[model samples]
Target: MEHEMRAEYEEGVEPGPDAEVKNWHMVRRDGIKAMCGRMLSESAATQPADRWGEPEGEPFCFLCGAVYLREVP
Candidate 1:
């Protein structure tokens, strides 16, 4: 799947930051907006659905290792 996906980008777009960025972005973005458009489209899709539900457990930042759980009121 990864190879095929890469081929699609290689043949369909220019070889530069835009293509690579979009390719990497799509890989990480998952199915959030694979069918609609570009990263901007994914950003727009995030607004309403961003708070659909609470995390069942604590969520951790992959980079800083910070943990966030549901804040109790």
Candidate 2:
């Protein structure tokens, strides 16, 4: 069975001009934990499944992507 992927944003306040930038992490569709085994907080922000890859200029979690590529078909 193939596991569905979901994107959840972890917002952080930076010191640069871009005060708030969202770093999206890939997680299993049915759970809040990311593919890299990081448990997302209850307040984490989520997007529609269609918008998973639409975050331009924002980086994805490398560990999550790596695990997804290796484990999810």
Query: What's the TM-score of every candidate structure?
Result: 0.15, 0.54
Candidate 2 global lDDT? 0.55
lDDT of 2 by residue, 1-73 (tens): 3344434433453234333434556666656787778766544555443444465424667787677677645
In order, candidate lDDTs are 0.24, 0.55
What is the C-alpha local distance difference test score of candidate 1? 0.24
Name the Cα RMSD for model 2.
5.5
RMSD of each: 13.7, 5.5
Q: Which candidate is the best by lDDT?
A: 2
Q: Which residue runs does candidate 1 get wrong by more than 4 Å?
A: 1-8, 12-22, 26-36, 39-73
C-alpha positional error of residue 36 in candidate 1 after TM-score superposition, expressed in Å: 8.4
